[model samples]
Target chain A: MTRTSAIFRRELSGYFTTPLAYVFIVIFLVLAGVLAFFVGNFFDRGQADLQSFFVFHPWLYLVLIPALSMRLWAEERKSGTIELFLTLPIRLSEAVIGKFLAAWCFAGIALLLTFPFWITVNVLGDPDNGMILAGYLASWLMAGAVLAIGAAVSAGTKNQVIAFVVTAALVFVLAVAGTPTVLGLLQGWAPSSVIRAVAGASLFGHFTAITRGVVDLRDLVYFLSIMVAFLAANAIIIDLKKAD
Target chain B: MLEIRNLVKKFGPLTAVDDVSFSVPEGEVLGFLGPNGAGKSTTMKMITGFLAPTSGTAVICGHDIEAEPLAAKRRIGYLPEGAPAYPDMTAAEFLDFIAHIRGFHGIEARRRIAYIAELIHVGDVLHQPIETLSKGYRRRVGVAQALLHDPAVLILDEPTDGLDPNQKYEMRGIIRDLSPHKAIVISTHLLEEVEAVCSRAIIIAHGRVLADGTPAELAARSRYHNAVRLDLASDEAAGIAAELQKLPGVASVEAAADSGQATLWVFPQGGQPISDAIVRLARTQGWPVTGLYVERGHLDDVFRTITAPDATGNALRDAA
Candidate 1:
């Protein structure tokens, strides 16, 4: 536990030592506000809840989370710090989990900065604070899943560009998997059970379902499993390519 | 102590480290000598538990690297090739983080970092970003981090690769100062460094150990060992060459005149000492001698002869 925390503290502080964290947070806030008030039509909807504000989180995370995560392992490999890091007296699992937690916490910090939006809605009308709290949980969980996928993809290569592009593409497929158009395309060829599983397993499907003022245990499990499964793959990929 | 047993690493069909084995006890510094891609770094990686070996294990102190990696790693301090560190971190921050990883925290971590900084002479730049520091400072920071934990064993891969002459001298001084308490294995491209700091030298090529001995012992393997070179005031290249060739224990004598001055080389038969014999012959013949000395075999010659690409059949085998 102490070893994990040591890696965790170093990784977390590493984010703030560069401009990357600030740039990401600024972009996230600007895009979230623009999409919420301008494209999302928050006032026009006449709702006290932050439904419109929470609705665009999946779209926002699809682009931004990978940016935050591409450097998790790829930069370490390119700079050769991974050798010094892995040789320390720590387990591979601890390093993987510690890095993931750091990125996840960073995303959480950015999400917390969007608190003024919550206050805006509360001042505009009497909002259901419980539902808004659920929205925050759902948004943070979805971001965690995206960051986890990015972490695994970043470990496969030393090139951050490849990690960025591949992670964006993979998350894009997951975000649109449950849409009517995609399910319609899959109807003709894939088996019915497989198509149903794909639809149920879609990131957007689980994500959108939870942002509607309720957090389901199944949806929480889905997000946690994605994080766990991908983080496991991240550790395995690092161990596999350690020689390179 | 560090004991490696038949470590082998194979990437598909290509063998990178082929059954390499050696041991280093406390108070000994072993110099690992090899060319590029000679499996020197690869073997160090396996020993430090950074890369899993294809078919062997390293025992550090008493812990096996594969079975009890954390315990073994806790007892080891490794400076990987190029001395990689976080570019964004200040030297102090990196050391503090390393101290944390080594199970030191709070006051203890701070104390260790300060001590290491002073010992390695990095106290001046401890607060500067590692990227902004000079190459020598960066390399010293690497060594400092490896020494922060004060492990029982240290594995440094090319610790002084690009340092200036003074920095290289200081780096070797640091290695020698720490040699009495810990087992050290360092690999370098500079052969002279073997004589400078290493108590024992291991020459490896083609992923195998070609020779292992003290610096002098490896130098003795050269054909020039115990040979004598004589300088004559006379420019006659032929007369002295024939006369010196007949001396007992003298294998052959060759004389050459360069710019009107004659130089004679007497190679001893079967690695015998022939300087005394040549001195007596010079006195009896009344040859006008200016300078003469016995040649301790050149390490470069021994290195070249052993690792030559077209070596004879038996020379290709591991001599260690």
Candidate 2:
């Protein structure tokens, strides 16, 4: 565990030493702001809630999370330093968890910097602060889920570009598979319960339920399970690569 | 102490290492000699527990490399083939990371890092990012990293692969200084490097151990009994070859046409000194012997003789 912390500190500092963390924060905040205020029509909707902002998060993360995680393991393998890291006394699972936590924390910071939106809603009207807090929690957890998936894909290869493309495609499919538009198209062929189950499995479905000021244990469990599944797969891939 | 027994590594259908076995006793430097693509790096990786061998075992400090990897790795320090280091971290930071993981703390870790930095002569570049340093300096950092935790065995693969001549010499001196306390294996193609630091040399080819002995012994094992090349100014080179062959212990003679030099392959027949016999023959013939020196055989000749196209080339060359 001490070795894990050492690797975690090094990886976290590495993010700040380069322009990656800064660039990711700026892009995330700007894109979130633009999508919320301009396209989502925060004022035109005249809503006292953050429904407009939360609606666009799935699409935003589908593109942004892969960009943030594409280099995590790919760059290490490309530079031939993965062997050094793996040969250390630390277990592979600890290293994977430490690196994932670093990226997740960096992403959390970017998400938190959107606090101005909370303040803006307060200034304009009386929005439900409780629901807003819930939205932030959901967003943070969803970001972790996306980051974990991206990290697992990243560990599969040495090419960052391919990692980004594959992870983006994967997250995009998972994000939209159970959306209303896709479910509506399948309504005629599938039963309502089947459609509901499919939509229930989508990232947006679970996140939307949480952002509505409801802390569902099932929703939290779902995201946590997905995060663990992907991270475990990542550990397996790293072990296989070392074996090779 | 380390022992590699019947080590074999295969990638699909291609065998990288083939039935290799050797043992490194405590406090002995074994120079691993081979040409490129000779599976030296692969062998080192297996011994360090980084790669698993297909069907063999390596015991390091009484720990099986495959079964007890962490324990085996704790006892071994490895400098990989190209000496790779994380380019983003400073030397001090990298060493600190290694120290922290090796379970050193606070003042102890600091003292160890300082000692290694000064030992490898990389103190000047301690604060700089590893990628910013010169190649020789980076090589020193690689060596420093291997020396950080003070492991019992050190496996250095081409330790001086990319250093300049002066740096190579200095690095050799550092290795020699460390040789008395640690069991070290320095893998390289440079014969002189073996002569400079290691007392024993193992010549490997096609992923198999070809020959193993002390440098002098290996060289002497391939030496012909008084076979000497003479560069003498003589109008009749063939006549000299014929006359020298008639002397005791002179089994055969071969003459080169271009240099007018002849090599007499002697057999130490009847316990006669081949040099005294050649000297008496040369004085009688009035052949001005320009150069006459006993050949101190080299590793190059042994390597070529063992790995050449025909195994009998060495025997035939010795006979004539």
Top-scoring candidate (DockQ):
1
Q: Candidate 1 residues A103-146, lDDT tens each?
A: 99999999999999999988999999998998898999999999
| TM-score between candidate 1 and the true structure | 0.98
| Native contacts present in candidate 2, fraction | 0.54
**Candidate 1's residue-wise lDDT over B1-320, tens digit each?**
89999999998998999999999999999999988998999999999999999998899999999999999999999999999999999999999889988899889998889899999999999999999999999999999999998999999999999899999999999999999999999999798899999999998888888889999998887778998878888766578888888888989887766766788888999898989878988899889888898988988888887777674514634443
What TM-score does model 2 score on chain A?
0.93
Q: Write down the lDDT of every candidate, Cα atoms only.
A: 0.91, 0.84
The number of the candidate with the highest TM-score is 1
> How far does residue B211 in candidate 1 sit from its true spot (Å)?
0.4
**Model 1 chain B: ten consecutive residues of lowest lDDT:** B311-320
Give the lDDT of residue B199 in candidate 2: 87
Which predicted model would earn the best lDDT?
1
Pairs of residues clashing in candidate 2? none
Candidate 2, which segments miss by more than 4 Å at Cα? A184-197, B223-226, B234-236, B251-273, B309-320
What is the two-chain DockQ of model 2? 0.62
